[model samples]
Target: MGHSNVSNFVLAVTVPLPSLLFYLSFVQKCDGDRWENEYWTWVCDWGRLHPLYLVNVLFFLNVDILFWVVGLVQQNVWLIDPYWTIIPVLIAHFYSAYPAAQYDLLRSRAALLLIWIWSARLTYNYFRRELWQWGKREDWRFTDIRRKDPRNWWWKSFFVCFVSQHTFLVGITLPFYSIFTNARPWNAWDGLAFLVCLSGITIAHVADTQLHSFVARNNILKDLGAPTEPLLNRGLWHYSRHPNYFGEQLFWWGLSLFSVNLGQSWAVVGTAINSACLAYTTVLVERKMVQEPSRADVYRQYQKSTSVLIPWFNRSTLVKSKTS
Candidate 1:
C-alpha cells in the first residue's frame, strides 16, 4: 500500500479500537457457566452473522442513548443535529476497521475520502448557522412539536428525537456496510459513483453558502432598521426553492450507487426513505414560509415559478402564459 493508503488504514483501524476492545472485554468478563456461555456464544454468532451491522447497532445505541439522556436533562434535543453530520464519517471508519471487512482498497479509500469531505462541509455549515454556539437551541420543528404537547414531550421525544433519527441515520448509511463487504476490483461504476458523490457535495456546499450569506445579510438589514428581504431568489434559490434539500438527497442517492455497483441494491432503501422524509420536510418548510404575512404572497409567486427540489428552468414563462 502507498503511504497515504497505509495512513488511512491505520487511522480507520485505530479510531474504533477503544470501543471494540471495551465491548470484547465486557463480553469476556461475562462468559463463564453453561447459560452464560450460551448467551455469549449467541451474541458472538450474531456478530459473525453481520459484524458491521452488529457493531453499528452497538455504537448507535451507545451514542444515541447518551444523547437522549442529555436532551432530557438539558431540555434540548439539538445535540443530534450536529452529530448527524458526523456519524456517517465515524461509521465509515468503523466499517473499515471491522475484522470481517473485505473491500477493494481504492474503493474503500475513495468512499472514506468522500465521506470525510461531506462531513466537514455539513459540520461547518451547521456550526456557522449556530454562530458557533453549542446547544443554544433545538430544531424549530422539534420545538414546535414540544410546544404543542409539553406534557408528553419528555417520553415522546425519546421516540421522536432519538429512535426515529437512529433509523434514518443507520438506514441512510447502508451503503457504507455494503461498500466494506465487497472486495470487487474498482471499475467504471466506482468512477461514476465518485463523480455523483462529488457533484452532490459541491451542489450542497454552494447552495448552503448562498443561503448562509442571505441570512447574514438579512441580519445586517434588520440591525440597520431596514426592511429585510422577504425572500431569497438569487443564486441556487432562483433555480430551486430548496436546492439544499435537493443536494442532500443527491448525496445519499449517490452513495447508494456504490452499493448498487456491488449488487447490494437493498442499500437504496435508506436513501429512498431519507428522500421521502426530506420531501415531507420541504412541504412543512414551504407551509411555514407561506404563513409569514410579509413573505406569503411573494413566496407563493416564487413557488409558482421555481422547482421545489430539483434544479430546472424557471417556470416564469408558464406563469405568464397562464396569466395571459
Candidate 2:
C-alpha cells in the first residue's frame, strides 16, 4: 500500500485504541469486589479512598498520554479541544456513579444534569467547527505558539500545552468531587446554583452562535476577495468583548457554589485558580486580536467601548463608539 494509506490506517486505529483501553480499565477499576479479591488487596486496604483517587488519576493520565501522542501524530495541538468539554462530563458521571460515604442523590443528579447540559452544548460548538479528521487546521492560538518556537514546540507542547491543560481539567472538576463526597441535601442553594449554571450555558450558547454567524459571514466575504467585516460588536458582543468567555467563567463559578454550600472551602480553590487561568486566557486572546493587522483597530475600538467580562448596559457607549 501507499504511504498515505498506511498513515490513514494508523490514524484510524491509534486514535480510538487508547480510549477503548481506558474505558475498559475504568470499568475494571470500578469493580471494587474484584480489586478486594486480588493480590493488590493490601494496597487497596491501605486507604479506602486512596485507591479510588489513584485510579482516577491513572485514568486521566491514560487519556492525557493518548491525546498527547495523537497530537504528535496529527501535528495539531488543538486535538485536546474536545477533551476540554468532555472531561467534566466524564468526571461528573464517575463521581455520581460512585458516591462517597455520604451521598445526596438529588443534588448529585441535579449537578450531573447541569454538567451534561454544559458539556453537550460546548462539545457541539467545538465539533461544529470541524470534524475530528486529520489534516484540518489547528487552532490559531496553537499555530501562533508553534510558530514562535518551531524547533522546541513539539517537546515543549508535551509539558506546556497538554499537561497543563490536563491539570486544569482535573482541578476544575473538584466541585463534582466535593458534591459527591458530601451528603448535603437539595436546598435553595442547589436550586440557585442550577439556575446560575443553566443561565451560563444559555449565555455561552448565544454568544457562540453570534460569533459563529459573524465569522461565517466574514469568511464568505473573504472568499469573494472582498474586505472582511470588522470585529463583531453587536448582540452579546456589544455588551462584553468576551461574552462566551464570561459565560464559561460563570459556569465554573456556579459549579463552585455547590462546594461553598457544602462548606468545602478547598473545592472553591479550583474555581479561584480556574478564574485566574481564564483571566490570563482572555488577555492572551484579546492581545492576539488587537495585534492582528486587520482586526487590531476594530478590536481596540471595541475594547474601549465594551466591558471585558461582564455584560452591562453599554448601549450608549456602543452607539457613541459606532458613530465616532
Candidate 3:
C-alpha cells in the first residue's frame, strides 16, 4: 500500500468473506437520528417484494457496513489522497508516475470527473427525495425487505441494507478512489478519455431530466382527474423504457473506462457489478407493472414502439404521417 502503483486486489475480493455468512443479530426498534435507528428504519418491513429483493437488500446492507470502516480509515489515517486532488493531479503527473498508461492522465481524469458529476447529481437527487420523506416514513424499498424476513430482520438487515449498499457504493467509487490513492498527474490520453466520459454523462443527464419532467406532468394531471398516460411516444421517454437507468449505467461505464486507461485492476468488474444491480431493478419494474392488465398492455406497446438506449425523433412515425 506504500507505492501509488500498488494495491491489494486480492484483499478487495476476500475481506468480505464473513459478510457472506451474514448471521442476523439484535436489531433496534425504529426511532432517532443515530446510525442504528437509520439502519432499522431502512430495514423495516414493507409488506411487499420478492425473495430476490431481500438478497439485494442484504447485499446493500453488508457493503455499507464495510464502507463505514473504509470511511473511518480515511478519516483517521491518510492512505489515499482526497479525490478532488487525486483526479486532476494524477492526470497531470501520469507520465512521471505511471508512464505505461501514458500516464494518459488527462483523458482518464476527464472520464472520471464525468462519472463523478453525473453519479453525484443522480445520488443527490435521490437523497433530496429521501430528505423530503423525513417525518413521514422510511423508503418503501426497506419496507419490502423487512416484510419479507420478519423474524430475521435484525441479522438480515445487518447483511442486506447495512452491508450491501455500502459495498456497492465503494465499488462504484473505486475508480476515483484509486486515482486518489495513486496520486499522479494528468496525461494527454486522460483528456480524450475524460471527454468521452463527459459526452456519455451529458447525454444520460438530458435524457433523465426529460423523462422525469414528463412523469411530473403526468402525475399532476392524474391528481387533477384528467386523463394521463406514460410519455413513451415523445421526448427521451420515446427512446428508453428506463431512461434514468440507462443514464446511471453510462455513469458507471464512464468511470470504468478511466480505470482501463490506468492499469490492471478490477474497475471493469465494478462496472459489471453495477450493471447487475440495475438489471435487478429493471426486472422488478417489469414484474410489478405486468401485474396490472391495462398498464401491462400499454407498457408492452411502449416497448415495441421505443428504442431501448438510443434517442431518436421517431422518424418512422413522421414518415408514415407524410405518406398518409
Candidate 4:
C-alpha cells in the first residue's frame, strides 16, 4: 500500500482499538472483581496501584507511537498541534467513564462541561488561525526546529515532539485522575475552580480573537503593499504581552484545584510543570519577536511597559530609567 494509506490504516486501527479494548475489558465489566483469570486479576491489581498506567499506555500507543510514525511517513510533525485541544477532553471523559471511577456526579459533570467549553474555544481558535484549512501549515516553531537540523529531524522529532508532549499533556491532566478516583462531595472549592476556569476561558477567547483580527488585517495590508502594524498592543495585549497564555495557565491551575479539593495536592505538580514549560516557551517567543526587524524596537518598548504573562496596568512610558 501507499505511504498515505499505510499511515491512515495505522491511525484507524491504533487510535480507537486500545480505547475499545479498555472499554470492553474494564469499563463494561463495571466490577474489577469479576475477572476470574489470575492474569487479568493481576493486571487489575497493578493498574490500581498505578492508576494512570493503563491510560498512559493508551496514550503511548495512540499518540506517541502513532503520531511519530505518521510524522515520519508524511514528513509533517505538526499532527499533534490540533489534537492538543482534543486529548484533554478525551482524557477527562475516559476518567469519568472508567469502571473504578467514583467521583461525585455533580462535580464530574461540571468538570466535563467546563472542559468541553475550553476545548471548543481552543479548537475554534486553531482553525480560525489556519483560515479553516486542515493541515495547511505547521506551527512556525516546529518548522524552525526542522530547518535547523533537517538531516536528523525525523528521529529527533520522536523525542522532541511526541515524547515531550507525552510528559506535558499527560501531566496537565493528572487532576482528572485524582477527581475520578476520589468521591468527595462538591464543595466551595469546586465552585471556585469552576469560576476560575470560566474566567480563563473568557480571557483566552478575547485575546485570541483580537490577535486573529490583528493578523488578518496585517495580511490584508501586506496584500495591498501597505505597512502593517508593528505589534498588537490594544485590548488584553495592552496589559500583558501574552494574555492567551496567561488565560491557558489559569485554566490548568484552576483544574488542579479540583484535585486539591479532594486533598490530593500532589496533582498540582502537573499544572506546575505545564506552567514552567509555558514560561520557557514565552522566552523563546519573545526572542523570536525581537529578531524581527520591523517589530523589534516596538516590542522591546512594549515589553518594558507590559507584564509578560499576567494582566496588569502598563508601566508609564514617560518614567525614564537609569539606563535611559
Candidate lDDT scores, in order, read 0.82, 0.75, 0.51, 0.85
Angstrom error of the Cα, residue 316, model 2: value is 4.3
Candidate 3 RMSD to the correct structure: 16.0
User: Model 4: per-residue lDDT, tens digit, 256-291?
Assistant: 999998999999998999899999999999999999
Residue-level lDDT of model 2, residues 164-187, one tens digit each, is 776687778888888888886889
Model number with the top TM-score: 4
Candidates 1 and 4 compared: the better one by lDDT is 4
Backbone clashes in candidate 2 total 0
lDDT of 3 at 218: 83
Return whichever of 1 and 3 wins on lDDT: 1
For candidate 2, what is the TM-score? 0.85
Which is superior by TM-score, 2 or 3?
2
lDDT of 1 by residue, 203-310 (tens): 999999999999999999999999999999899889999998888888888899999999999999989988888889999999999999999999999998999889
RMSD of each: 7.6, 3.8, 16.0, 3.9
Q: Answer with 1 or 4, whichever has the higher TM-score.
A: 4
List candidate 3 stretches off by more than 4 Å.
1-116, 127-139, 181-188, 310-324
Q: Per-prediction TM-score, please? A: 0.86, 0.85, 0.59, 0.90
Give the total clashing residue pairs for model 4. Answer: 0
